[model samples]
Target: MSDRSYRFTHAITRKPAASIIAGLRAVDTGTPDLALMQAHHAAYIAALRATGATVIELDALDAYPDSVFVEDTALCLPSGAVTMRPGAPSRLGEAAEMAPHLEALYADVKRISGPDSFIEAGDILMTETEILVGRSARTNAAGIAELAALVAPWGETVREVHTPPGVLHFKTDCSLLDAETILATRRLSATGCFTGYRLIDVAEGEEAAANTIRFNDVVLMPAGFPRTRDALLAAGYDLREIGNSECAKLDGGMSCLSLRFTSKP
Candidate 1:
């Protein structure tokens, strides 16, 4: 019921630029079709609005190829917003670009500023009482240290979780389904990072489905994963499937598409 939970009231998303065709991809899934990705991005913003959030859609940043993934720029906490120090050099400018919008909605905005610190919000998982951070190649110790300090005053605890190899982010392997439930892959589940939560396992061969995002009452999942769809339906969730084939090429998922927050803009 709190802002730290899935009951979001506001969201921030950016339109994907035509330059998104050149977004960084780990395995060379080939360039995404610009027109198709834009259509998908539109539908994603619509989905966020349907969740009852006042969605703020920013103009596309043509200069930044990966600017559409706005969630990586900051962590929206109930108290304020914390700008992230992106691990990817190409994405470093995104934090500054997202500042004006965040400041307009939030009165307080903190940052992780260190010469050696690098953290992407994609590596941090938020819950009602605690935050699980991934010590991935993109997120370093200094970044985690900074986050722990900012959230401590709000009565939130930060715990570090070991990320599996070959993943771009911690959320690439799992996502929170609800307040007490988590949807995760077998690989990440074995890490024992979610020992206290009720975990719902994704269907075999549907590991990518683990990245679904629960906004308010519905879960926005990636389309084309039938087995995983059945798993979520069986779990009693009202689900909405979004096309993500194009975004997946750039290592993005449902959670990376927008920054969901409860504060009114």
Candidate 2:
């Protein structure tokens, strides 16, 4: 296994369902156009492949409206994957649907089974040394404790961070740019969730810009946030921009679309 937690060699994604319009929407971005969403998804997948991680494409479940946001289903760590129990009732089935895929990829797959535990991978950020868990409406303290216990054997630690008010997920406001850096909105940074890492603030009014995913060598970010794009590039990182106009309408973005990981020996 590699030493870095974010160096992924594989990725998993599911297509958006026709019922995606029924998916959770915290903001009024309008209904997503399915055809346009697919095109964006294609571009997102292309970017993931460009990172040199083999993409494991899964079929869309017409039953789960938010299945396309696969990252909510599990946490991919260096030791193994922890199949999650999503806090959103509508999204609960997603973890079970994604478990087999994770089991096929990792040797030691663990699961969060507490009847009251509920967490989503999007709310959990795996930094180089610790797991920064966002305590939000979508993730309960029980879930965080369960997750911490599940990965304790791997020498991975978990720390709880307060999510900023009015965000759907913690990742909706911040993301790990590299081992020692975080791309965050000023609002989130003000909360003091990130203490030791260098904060690269996104352009004012581009708070969503901090949600990009750092793949192997290239970070995949949403297009149209030009000022934020410039900021990311100026910080000395390679990038691949993908248009997520449709997905954005339903509270989705680059990191929401895929579950990236590396297999164990």
Candidate 3:
């Protein structure tokens, strides 16, 4: 199994902008406080850096309120990086903005050029053995096909799957814990997409905790899901809980703030 899946040496994150109050959302629970979100973003970055990984912090793009969720902009693999074509019109340009940054770090950077292709890294989960893509409103079959074609030469396998209905992204309810273990929500696990992996279901009613990220030695999860947190702790993961209430107002969470990867210059 490739440790590249989770043992990353670098990560890229964008600061949350003041315009985050205008960020897209399925339902407006409340306005996101920029100052609070920024504080949370800093904590998130600190957690990533705590793993001894170099983090590239990018300036915020006020033009795109949702630009803070950099994971949706591209897919980073040990082989190369592929710029995504987001389905949301407002987020489409965010991918292009991330391409140059990726190109500077990866020798083999590619893009999903099909006009009809629409995919987001947030809909993708890279495991030790394969790439699992959950088709969502932001990710389509064409995007998946393009991504598959782009990475096939690198010997990576792509497995198409379905995101739970109503979820913003496939990863909204699941995350890879390690080579063989996954932390997921029962609603998503019930689909049988994770049949072969050792699965840890998030505590009932704490489904939001499913979007955690296992970065190197620490598993970064959002604060406030004690039941689920305790469960992960029991499983022996080094956990760090970051405040995500502000980002959560926009349906964003732990994994959405950054693009984690290890690349050869």
Candidate 4:
């Protein structure tokens, strides 16, 4: 196995109204108002680097305005990387843009074709024993089956989790905070979603704040969500709250800001 730590490379792009479902009618719809998005992406990249992980920055794909969020369309593992066929037609270009980077990162890079199969990176959560994939509109049954076959040889089990129909994606409602624990929203559990893993509840109205990224002992979370942040801090986690107001306006939170990976031992 490779000794090098997993590194992340991402492109920061301008947010478009089409990318954000809630802000489609706003005046700043198509403008190049990427300043805040860029800053948040940069901050996430910086935080990942602080974990002593190698960081690679890919050139922006001018064709796709939302290409900066590399996680939405691909899954990278030490053995190889899988390029997903985004369920959203508007985000299809992200898979094409991510292929070259994956090819360079690992000797074996595979792709899941659409028209029959569709998978989004946000639906995949990796743990030491298995790869939990969320089955949602963005990630279909075929996609999960294909992914399971692709990673089986690597000794990784692919478990399927049912997602709430109303949720936009899985990561937004549920995320793995560590190997043993998950920070999940009630919106997800109450809907009978997340079939396979253990669910740890966040307080009412604290669902959005449940989305967190674990970097070693430190957890990166959104600012202004003090209830959840304080809960995590009191639990012995070194919580780092970052401002993501602008990104939130575009339907983005901490997880949407960047794609993170760790090399296998």
Q: What's the TM-score of each model vs. the native?
A: 0.97, 0.97, 0.98, 0.83
Best by TM-score: 3
Report the C-alpha lDDT of model 2 over 147-243, residue by residue, as the tens digit: 9999999988999988887888899998888888899999999988898889999999987788998888888899989999998888898989899
Worst 10 residues of 1 by lDDT: 1-10
Cα RMSD, model 1: 1.2
- 29-82, model 4: which lDDT tens digit per residue? 343346665666677767766766566776665566566556777777767778
**Tens digit of per-residue lDDT, candidate 1, span 72-111:** 9999988889999999999999999998888988888888
User: Cα RMSD (Å) per model?
Assistant: 1.2, 1.2, 0.9, 4.3
* Model 3 lDDT, residue 101, Cα: 98
Put down candidate 3 lDDT per residue, 24-81, tens digits, no spaces: 9988899988998889899999999999999999999999999999999999988788
Tell me, by lDDT, which candidate is best.
3
| Candidate 4 segments exceeding 4 Å error | 1-33, 190-199, 263-265
Q: How many clashes does the backbone of model 4 have?
A: 2
- Model 4 has an lDDT value of 0.67
Tell me the spans in candidate 2 whose CA falls farther than 4 Å from its real position.
1-3
Alpha-carbon error at 5 in model 1, in Å?
1.9
**Alpha-carbon deviation at 265 in model 4, angstroms:** 9.8
Q: Candidate 3, clashing residue pairs?
A: none
Backbone-clash count (model 1): 0
Cα TM-score of candidate 1:
0.97
